[model samples]
Every structure is written in C-alpha cells, then in structure tokens.
Target: MSTLYVEQPWTSMSLLFRPHYRVEVFDEHDTPLMVVRESSGPGLQRPLRHTGFSGWTSFDLDVVAPHGQPIMHIAKQFGRRPHVRVSTPAGQLIGTIKTHGAWKQSLHDPSGQQLCFFTDIGRIDTGARAKRHGKRVRRDRVQINPQVTEPLRSLATACAVAFDVVRGTGTRHTSSGGVDWPV
Candidate 1:
C-alpha cells in the first residue's frame, strides 16, 4: 500500500429489475487498478427475488481484472443482520460485510475480527454520473482508513455494492416528507 489512498468508485444501474454494476478499483495510485463487473441474467433468481424472502434468495457478484481474471467474490448470506461473505477467486473467505443497520456495514476478517466499517450517507448527486441516471447515486466508496490492510480495503469497498441490490426490485424508495427522501 502507498502513503496516499483514493476511494475506489463503483456505480450500479439496474435494467428491467436486474441489477448491474461497474466498479473501478484504485489503490496505491489515483487511477484504477481493476474492474468489477456484475453481468448475468436473472435466471431463477428473478422469480425467486420477486415473491421469496431475501434470506431464501441467493446471488453471486464478482470483481474481476480487466482481462477477466477473478479477484474477489461476493455471496450474500442468510442472516437476520444481512451479512455478505466476500472471498478470493479460489473460494477462500477473506472478509464478511455485516450490516449493523440501514446506515452502516462493518467488515470482519476470516477470523471474525472486525477490521473496518463503511457507512451509507444516503444518495449523492454531485456529478455527471449521478445526472446520467436522472437520480442520485448511492455513495458506495466510503473512505477506508489507511491503517487497514490493503486486501480488506479493496474487499470491503467492492462488496459495498451489495447494499443496494434490492431484493424485491420494486420502488423501494419513494417521495416522503414532501422532499423526495429515500425510504
């Protein structure tokens, strides 16, 4: 790891109720080191995500290199707290992201040691990326403390996208308080 760090940015846009994401992972430099892609048909998960409980539905997301080499894997787990298990390409568990509530998720290493935390501060409309969607994009790349391990920083950031992959795929957010706040 370098002395300087930049938050790796990830953007997700759903198509026809199917979630798709594009992530640019950065470390040790200002530019991206790799790409994380979630590209797959809904298949059986479609109907399952519709009527089934989230704990009963399963899906997998991957972070891969530009050459299509696997880097990290995310498999959301069945837990009352909405935990997501992150692993290496070889299936070795690396870290788990367990949500404490709607506003925070914590990263735990394989040994059940909590490493760091990422928080959701709601949607942000700061740039063309957000405007491209005609809506605010959820801020996924919360700054990980530089003291944390490199692997943990990357894994936690990549896995953060799972936070927004709505299980029911309907309008989860609606206008409230006459201010259009997300619910």
Candidate 2:
C-alpha cells in the first residue's frame, strides 16, 4: 500500500510566457520521488500563442526519475476533453487516461479495466460561466484501487498528473471569492 503525492506549481500570468510546467511526485513521508516536465517541442509555440484560434493541440511530456533518468512518456490527444496516453521509454503503450465528464476522469489499462478514478469536488460551469470563472473553482481528488500492482500504479499516478495539466488545474490560479461554475 504505497501512496504518492502529486504537486503542480502555481503559475500567475501564464498568457505572456509559455511556461514549462513541472509536476512533482512525493512519497508518503513527503520525500520527492519523481519529476514530470513539459517538453517545449517544435510547433508548440504557435498553438500556445494563438490559443483561441487553435482548434486542437497535442503535447508530449517526459517523466523523469529522481536521479534524472527518463522513465516514461505522456502524450495528450487533441480534443476538447482530456485524453492522454502513457507509454514506456521505448514507446510501448502502457495505458490511457480519459475524462468522462466534468467531474470524473479515469485511468484504464490496455484491456479497458479502470485502475483509478479522479473526481473534481467543486462546481463545473459551462459557456459564459466557464469563461468568466476558469478552473479556479474546482479541486481534484484521485483514488487508486488497491488491487492495482506496482508498475500500473506508477503509470496511473503519472496519468493523473498529466490529466491535471491538460485540464488546466495546475496553470489556473484560483481566487479567494467567486461563485461556483454552473453545472
């Protein structure tokens, strides 16, 4: 029964600069375990700059060990909702992470059994409300099934962090006071 804590830094005023988002994974005692960093690959700057015009964009990130060895890769699919693929360093598919609705996201094995679930505990607004409130009102909580094994657990953790990144939970700054987004 190992537990992992994932943390993403708060970035203010992200529109001006393309920030390299780094997500840190920690152990139960708060010791650092791994670091996942966003990759600034070619053609990424265009979509980031013209966000409104860009219909869909893909991103690739690297998961690195504490000693700086690359262990896994995360690739996001282009779409309105979050969809990510976890792969080995050699590019073999491990599993997938997908957003089912506003509050629920799931990690599934290649065979399609859900290994973990992520639920957002706050209000989810659409249309004008979402534009006005952004992602500030939501808090994400991840639950991994105890039956999952070691390697899959690690992959699930990485997928959850990647989902957070794609969902803008890490980049959006929450305000002290605001109405929750409409359901």
Per-candidate TM-scores read 0.59, 0.64
Instruction: Please write out the lDDT profile of model 1 over residues 1-183, one tens digit for every residue.
Output: 132221223223222232233445444444555665554644555554433243345546787765788878877643345567788889898877766655556677888788766532122111122221354333333344456555676555554434443222221212111322221
Each candidate's number of clashing pairs is 0, 0
Query: Which runs of model 2 end up more than 4 angstroms from their true locations?
Result: 14-18, 45-56, 111-146, 166-183
The residue pairs found clashing in candidate 1 are: none
Any idea how many clashes model 1 has? 0
- Please provide, for model 2 over 87-156, each residue's C-alpha lDDT reduced to its tens digit, 9 standing for 90 to 100: 8888887887776653466767867677666432112222121111243112233455556675567566
- After superposition on all C-alphas, the RMSD of every candidate to the true structure, in Å, is 6.5, 7.9
Report how far off residue 59 is in candidate 1 (Å). Answer: 2.3
**Which candidate should be chosen as best, given lDDT against the real structure?**
2
lDDT (0 to 1) per candidate: 0.48, 0.54
